[model samples]
Target: MLNRKIATSTAAVALLLTWSAGLTPAHAAPSSPAPTAAGWLARQLVDGERLETVVDQVPYPDQGATADAVLAFAAAGVAQDNATKATDWLARPQTLAAYLGDGTTESYAGAHAKLALVAQVQGRDPRSFGGVDLISRLTALQAPSGRFSDKSAYGDYSNGITQSLAVIALERHGTAPEAAVDYLVDAACQDGGFPLYLEQTPCASDADTTGYAAQALLASGRQAEAARALEWLEGVQGPGGGFRGSGPTPQENANSTGLAAQALRVGGRTAAADKAVAFLKSLQVGCGDAARAGAIAYDATGFDQGNATRATTQGITGIVGVGLLELSAHGEATAPASDCPITTTTTTTTTTAVPATTTTAGTSTSSEPAAAAPVTSNGTRQLARTGFEPGPALALGVLLIATGVLALLLARPRRAER
Candidate 1:
């Protein structure tokens, strides 16, 4: 993402071509001053200034959620109080292993890797973060086959997420093991994509797993393997330019597309990368509610009520051409404005109300639905849902004004739920 460091003309030319690929749609759409998309993520802190998930009215600190909060802040260049608070919480000496202590259920190994990456991105030392030498801790967990795992006893913990994060985290400190690299490189399925669980050969390919594994393979200097995985991603790209999630349902969401976009760009598939980036940009909330601007949603649903915070955080990195691992490094992502993608597909949150129905009392119906009026493609109104209502249209004519900060508040996924 730090373009100023790349000296080659080819790299510079590529940056030029994709810098503004899909940002215009967001920029052109106008709404009142509101909370930036990144702002939505900052508000999720519960107790101890650390991230927490509610479980039966009890609050438990979550490493993954906290790590996500840090990445969200870093991606947006936000250096505000909340970001500092989260960083400070992470830096506490006693919190090191405790943050990743959910060995019974969570991937404790993966937590170490994610926090190590987070520390590095924040310009801290991964070796001694929270008074814990995570690099060493993670290294000790690597199996003879180079795959990383805590081998948690309660539930499945080892997966592409665990391996990929470990690979990337170790890479930042120049401690990545070659054997570990091979573990991911050789885990490729027959279809060229990677699966979350390496249960057997010829496994099904998944977007999230494949995306992370492709990144892991690329970081490990196994470009051939990474290329094959990337090729599989291209094969599954949706018509709207986003990549689909794994499994039979195969829905494309911000998380899947963001990872694939990063992998594609890193793999040297410029056009494909641009398209994926565009797809993500198209989902960004230009501005509608006061606090949802600059946030990316899961898909065309623009700020999914369940994914607004996590999705927007991850999506910002993709739009900047940096994968989650790369986000761990300290630098600004440089890009041209023209390279940003504009969204062509708009997901409607509401449809127009029927004109009116005669009341059972033999009088004209007087009440309109409590929901906001339905918006049209141009973000204008063919007619307000009712004759008395005014449309909520941004100057860009955003197809609808469904995005708002409240959506983010309601969308935060609690760690307890997992």
Candidate 2:
């Protein structure tokens, strides 16, 4: 009888273990880093339409930032709907008026070039964007020297960013002008990298300018020059694989690192590219916070909401190993959570049995069982992030006295202005 009782207890325990296994919830699988970041970024958009920049307690539509967001969406191969909405918002007449000017007194070479690329990526006709001829307008701004200049009284702020953009846009449209291609090639610094400001003395090379210039060169069939530029980039890459802009005291940041990584990958530097992706992933918010999980921080200092928009937007390209020229949207619309480190917890019931692993937003390693967090039906954690999204794509103070001032400032645009 004693033996029989012992056997019965063993059988009960086995049955309980089997039953518990069946009851264990299937944890959500974490998404790849690219989609993970892209998903979080898609949520950051205000009303899923645009990103707004505030100046002097006022909000204006940030077309530059919005354009970057579209490119980010396309590069990640996710968030096609959001990309479409953003492009549509950009194509709005009022929005175009604010960004590209009314064809007279305020046409920006950089704005036209950047928006033309954005329109092309969205499968929209750049020729007829917002009832404006982007191609002709952009070409019209090209000087005799082949540099695309801002044809406005405010002065020319066109730099390598705008020039590279113009070349790529024109190349994609059909054929890049010979003069434009030559101008881009001639702008290469002595170090084989390109300068952000072509007019800057000594022709100091920076990662941001070199990255775009390399891509533009490749697009224009200048393989030899592009190779030289990529070589220079390989030299400037930080030991940890991050890159900083060209400056007296450059500190590694996501924006420059992101663009450099894109160029390296396109230049066929696989080993270097992998290192860059790893470096970018290191900056990603892996676990702990549900809402900020997939967001990539600006640097080692950690994630800051104020700077996260540009950081994540540019950073995802490197994470996914795509360049601006090769970006497109063709994946599922659903945003996936990042694959965070697994957290194991034990639950005590009638028997001291360990529960199956479950998916939790953010990384945690607490031994104590965590209470269940609310999840949507499809399993995405609801975002707690809110308010106007900032982008570093455009910077302009609002003033009616000089509406054209926006275009003038746009001539010399920054990649991070929003």
lDDT of 2 at 140: 92
The lDDT values for all models are: 0.61, 0.74
| Model 2 lDDT per residue over 1-418, tens place | 3333334443344344333332322222224667778888888888898987777768767899889888888888888888988898999999998888878888999999999999888888999998989999999999999999886777888999899999989988998899999999999989999998897788889898898999899888899999999999999888878888766527788888888888889889887777777677667665455677677777766777667777888888776666666665666665555555466653423332223322112222233111121122223443322222221111122122133433444354354544
TM-scores for candidates 1 onward, in order: 0.66, 0.75
**lDDT leader:** 2
Prediction 2 TM-score vs. true:
0.75
Model 2 backbone overlap count: 14
Question: How big is the RMSD of model 2?
Answer: 19.8
Residue by residue across 164-242, what tens digits does model 1's lDDT show?
Answer: 8889888888958999888887777888998887766658788888888888777877888888998999999887678
